[model samples]
Target chain A: MSKKNYIRPLDIKHGRIDMGHGAGGRSAAQLTEELFLAAFDNPFLRQGDDGASFPIPVGARMVMATDGHVVSPLFFPGGDVGALSVHGTVNDVAMLGATPLYLSASFILEEGFALSELKRIVDSMAAAAREAGVPIITGDTKVVERGKGDGVFISTTGVGVVAEGVHISGRNARAGDVLLLSGTIGDHGVAVMSKRASLEFETTMESDTAALHTLVAAMLAAAPGGVRVLRDPTRGGLATTLNEIAGQSGVGMVLEEAAIPVAPQVEAACELLGLDPLYVANEGKLVAICSPESAAAVLAAMQAHPLGAQAVQIGVVTEDAHHFVQMNTSFGGRRVVDWLSGEQLPRIC
Target chain B: MSKKNYIRPLDIKHGRIDMGHGAGGRSAAQLTEELFLAAFDNPFLRQGDDGASFPIPVGARMVMATDGHVVSPLFFPGGDVGALSVHGTVNDVAMLGATPLYLSASFILEEGFALSELKRIVDSMAAAAREAGVPIITGDTKVVERGKGDGVFISTTGVGVVAEGVHISGRNARAGDVLLLSGTIGDHGVAVMSKRASLEFETTMESDTAALHTLVAAMLAAAPGGVRVLRDPTRGGLATTLNEIAGQSGVGMVLEEAAIPVAPQVEAACELLGLDPLYVANEGKLVAICSPESAAAVLAAMQAHPLGAQAVQIGVVTEDAHHFVQMNTSFGGRRVVDWLSGEQLPRIC
Candidate 1:
């Protein structure tokens, strides 16, 4: 700390990132101490080791997940790349019914990017991590030439621990399982798209980018071993995630379109853009499959949590050799909910 | 597996990556199964959950580390980005005196890049993981539009475990401790620089990118609690890393330039480029600090390993409030080995 005091402070208000910030030299150290370290200060990071070392609770299974967030417009209506990066990986670990313990982030910044923007993102990330009760214990930063990279790409890795007797996996879904969703879909995708497309919606739509570990904890607590499969419907959205589970579990699914939750604003925006709500990405929402007997308790637990207040049983797993996902439309006709075939939205996180 | 079988085989021979490959849809799944899954097949990855879950050894401390690789030329004299990505994170975890167990990778690929080249990199990564006996259990991928990214950027996170009674940190270095270097410096930096500059030396030099966990294990076993600090001089090379250690331990250092190890070719290349060997990066080398009584044993252990065959005692820690790293040059002059000030070679990692 004393040694760092002698160096000039980073010009966060007016400076832009340059190759020196990533050279692993004095400028890099100065930037790290002034910006990143100041925001992510903790005992593990304070140790100044190449890695962070911590004690793990005995008998707990370890869960590890990673996500590369390349969302366009770094900032959106409800969230920015910083918050999304933390939430995305945190939810992935939570989807395994584990309690996220720590996170590690890697940043690739393009030269000429604003240091002010970088600081804002980092502050958002720090806030999100605090809200999720997960500390980012270690990280690395690099820089690429101006045209060689986007403004910034954040890659986050989350590590968590699951208590004994909790088993969750896509393959754990059974033919008699019931499917539940933790909130409205299409919000994140539509929000980002709206900003990019400059669509004027009747109401402002915000990205549902959030950490779901607490919601997951509540659900797991209510239906301990009954919860079978948990997954966040992200890039490919609900339809694709369902299809993946159906394939993994060797079963088919039947969804009641009317039971699925979608915000009016998001639905209207999707319709206007010719995008199907089912194929739109989500950041905070999740689809869970559990034993039929546990559906009521799980649903009750989810509804009690703020993040999952819109929880509902939207579908049921069924035995089928073809492993198809069919939706019973509100109009009383059934159609195959096929896997998303192409890019509905690129770099949508 | 059956669901993936129906998708058209990826055109690895002539096709290039498209936006759809990272859309998190059918194509994304196909790319993952055909390319990533096939290469990194293991039980943890086969679980197919949002994250990978595994049981940890009881009472063992956990070590987590991450690194972002943005090397130019993609392929260098001895290694490519893929292998470098694996080695870099693995070494970071090992620096904490831990045995690396698992890795998670996140790739950001520029759209329209060749699939064949991506396959080569992934295959090399898989090979490196296998060689190190570590499994890449979880990962993510994103595609940025052309001009928004270089060919590819990789971020890898490593998780490892350390047995009880193993204490290692940069702050552990004491004033009277001895400093040891694993091998010659500047090879990695000079090699990548040569490839980028198209320099034709009388003899080709290869990037010394390698995993140092085995070498570290040998040294730890030999010296036990006597080993105080360990670090790999990757980005800022020997000088910057040493400065960091000195600052962390609140001590100064005196190095014998005649005793330091540097390959003749690397020396000539650095001289030609007007670079200091101390400031040039090395991928496969490390610096260790230990008590004076344990130096013989630690150096002996390092010499026994092929990666550390050129290990030597190059310096000693000294008590100084200034925390300076001074070297007694072969020319009979003493000079302070300062922290690297600016970018010498960007993206040299």
Candidate 2:
């Protein structure tokens, strides 16, 4: 053991967690500050209310989304289950073209969870929720016996309000609409997998786990009527989302490989692992299927937003009973963008 | 093995579940009919929509609630996990004075989860949701590798609309409010524990998992402004719920043990297990704290419902900054109803 351990100020940073952190005691408060408040520092969350209350804007509809995170490892390279949980649900609610607002978190920790690590993850989640302007309010904490549960599982429910005249959905795309892609994909899937697989890459690439609600709001303001559909390509990546839209709307799609974007590192990693980047997951990117007339406006709006800086027009909607998703090749060939049989990188369903 | 195994359609009285029941084919349908539907027969459930659709009444707001069932050993006396899951969430949403409208279900099944068992559960949930005048719509299913997951976990989310001007909460209890309970307590907990402990009761006991929304709606209609607080004593039982309410509303509670109701069988079981029936869980019960003037009206409303036939006035709110929950015993004794220190029984939470 390090000799300095006996002399330090209890080493909140280096120490493992105990029951006191979840005990609603002094340690719990410190954990909240050092870990949660540090990662998420905003006015509403800073208020620390039993429940958050805000003014309801006129002609706006609210969207609420909740998610539970029960990842195995407490700490991951780019993120932990805590922050990912906040971002995952924020994005889900954001995908509806709403201005994401308050968030509620419920944590079920297995007894003996390291307080230090729990604090770290909580801090990260709080930070993300804070920066995204979403406050965590009305949270619940419970502990299960060591053998009865995994380390911890976090469930977050997000609420937001959508402006009027904004209609976006998986089934909104028509036969003549154009589909746009927001930058390179598969970074998130590869990043999480690399950590899980203990693999190393030539260059470190962090998972794209940022909030995209702000970007969505900006696009809605730019071309309110032009947008047809907005969807985050997360679980099954672009292929699955597009396929879902196609099946829901009873339409087909055509994509251009030359226009499609992929990070070189991500592509190489997929090849090495026998995975398809198209089928790989993405947490930060989105697909906007819109009418051709408003394509330029939506593209311009997307590029203006930091998260959508690399946005590009990559496809168009088509009429087909089979609802096949086809993509053009970089080599001037074409192939079907089929449904993923299983998740490219298995984490949780 | 019985030679009758090869014989066609040979069976015992009610029949027992076997491996083939969970295989998702013919036996599944039979199991659904014999077990789930037979117990939960109703009209709306027979339609079997992806989600239930119904019209919302005017002058009322909608409420939605969802709960997940990952309970092991699907079948239990009085109710299995399937029926319990449906009743559990429905009651949560219903306790808020809103009429549950529709429910959405998502199932995560470990590979090889028997089809018959799955069907039985689904049908049971459908029946409960239907009986409660709520529909099951828009469902999802995912299969995980055998070792990666448990047998099955069903998540059900319900939506309901609340009536205007009805403000009910744990924090709404006032200094002079009276507390009332719907019926005898702890039957559900004892029923479940009996099976878990493999103990045969001197008199058979069944769980009290039932819909309380109808009772709640009736209460609201009976005395809209009279009811201040409403809570279903589920996990930590009546004592825990009252304590929470007392803490939240910043008021103390004084209960008369003679006024509280408990089935003799439940009381006997609690004595055998060395557990407090007041702290044991109750699925089909509620604690209502209301103004003294409206107590009779609220009691009358609760009594009109089948779930609240044994409604009783138990206590009253008192002025105390410490928010102590004290009980005056039937034997002219008194004791504090403290917060649950450890689990009454793990996993009941």
Candidate 3:
């Protein structure tokens, strides 16, 4: 603690948030100067404006996405709520084949929360944003009464610029397109569940919460006009996301069970919980639908990326009276993979 | 309920939020389709993508703003959490003289909260957005267990487009500029406090929550480069905001307390609560700094707008050693109006 500074130094070890911290007063400014500004040191944010202003490139179209992360158990195996918040919104913007640029984060903190834990989380988030090349330009922080909120909830909004003539959407899929999986699924959901339940597995399960914009950029570079849709299965997992794509595109999908990538440990955890691996969440994996002609190129590009080493073709699009996503089982049977019917696990972002 | 529809209709009147509502399943889809999609029906949202994509106007720069609303007693006399969420971010973007284009809303729902209340809030938000000529392009919703969250907290991010050569910021306030206020202060804070405390005044106090983009546009049109800075007095109120501007601009401010507009009822309420009117919040009011030569035209333009009928010049920028914001009281005394030091009220927004 510096003797010259008038504001009391925050007891990072065991201090609780008081109402003055969020009252938009001197205490609030101290918190911002001491914690937030120190963590996210960016030029745009240093402008000290309520909102940031920046020049847009010529002929660039803007894409924006917002995701609220309310995951329980702030820390998980391979990720925490902080990193997941950055990855979730960045991936959302990336799904449109846009170059994610700026992000705004709003934190809702519960009083009595630990400052050391908050510092760790904020540092983690800063690292994630730095690694992804998307800066947290501006942000807001609010504290609620101890019992009024969970430990912390973060809502992140990302802004990206997409070049002209680069159109990608879920509705762009067609009957003859191919669906590719960008690695193993269900790691995030399984990891969180295993930690929550204190279940031990032979191999440690880790949440696949890495940012996927770079992977998307690689795929786009390889097959620009051939890519139809890029969706990261988060809350509803792979099966539900595929169904959403099918419904939006008005086509049916047939998946090959043998080609679907799943880690052995994730499968074991899902079995123990009686959860369907198909409906489990994956933070890092993505499903890319592309034209048949470009499928090979896109798959090769995805495989070349570090995040998609296990990329494989998992499904084919088909014409159907109803938009349905069906799976071909290893036993030579077909079952409609519908949207999840109930909550698999809450707060598993 | 329609007999042909297979999905069960939501019990808006008697139902409480369950885990399935936010599980990214069929039930979640049904809730989204029946409630949110039905309320916020727009083309960009109908695309059903993770993020919304849209074209930007040529030569237009992008402006972004985000705010998290966690007001207690979710509903008040003239507004609720919904309308506040829309207006808060919209005003933030508008303060920069940008035309608000789209908004992204994320809701954190507490388990066991009433569905009817949620519907009312969402409908209010939709109405606010529509009236402001801004559509909610995308959104995310999550649910937490009972006792873990307040009924609901909404976080909104707004994207706006600004034309070239238009730059408005707090740092633009220079010595010799005239400071004009849009309208009476303390309405929103008083209204919320009255409701929270169940106070009955002779005349009902109503929140001044409103979208101010059109008003700002009118002022900007009157004198484009003449305007220096525009700021909305929100959490820390007018005095705190002025202090921030002074610090940012490295100039001092001198205010005429008598010229500052305040409703009689609001003043009385503030007196009863032992709160300073200068520190009470005003959601719809704005402080605009402009050259003395252009102050009259800007004030006239602000007065012509519906939200700023009581526009008046209340202060002027001055060259001082400490960049202090001082007020000349009606009693012929001067006092420095410093930043708020402690909590007056929490979650008043």
TM-score of chain A for each candidate?
Answer: 0.98, 0.86, 0.97
Q: Output the better candidate (1/2) by DockQ.
A: 1
lDDT of 3 by residue, A179-235 (tens): 999999999999999998888888999999999999999998998788988999988
lDDT of 2 by residue, B111-131 (tens): 555656666676677667767
Give DockQ per model, in order. Answer: 0.84, 0.10, 0.61
Best-fitting candidate, measured by DockQ?
1
Global Cα lDDT for candidate 2? 0.67
By TM-score rank, best first, the candidates go 1, 3, 2
- Each model's Cα RMSD: 0.9, 8.0, 2.1
lDDT of 2 at B255: 97
Candidate 3 chain B, poorest ten consecutive residues by summed lDDT: B1-10
| TM-score of chain A as modeled in candidate 2 | 0.86
What is the lDDT, from 0 to 100, of the residue B14 in candidate 2? 36
Q: Scoring model 2 with DockQ, what do you get?
A: 0.10
- Evaluate candidate 3 by giving its C-alpha RMSD to the native, one decimal: 2.1
Model 2, runs deviating above 4 Å: A1-74, A101-108, A137-149, B1-72, B101-112, B135-149, B154-161
Q: Is candidate 1 or candidate 3 better by lDDT?
A: 1
TM for every model, in the order presented, reads 0.99, 0.82, 0.97
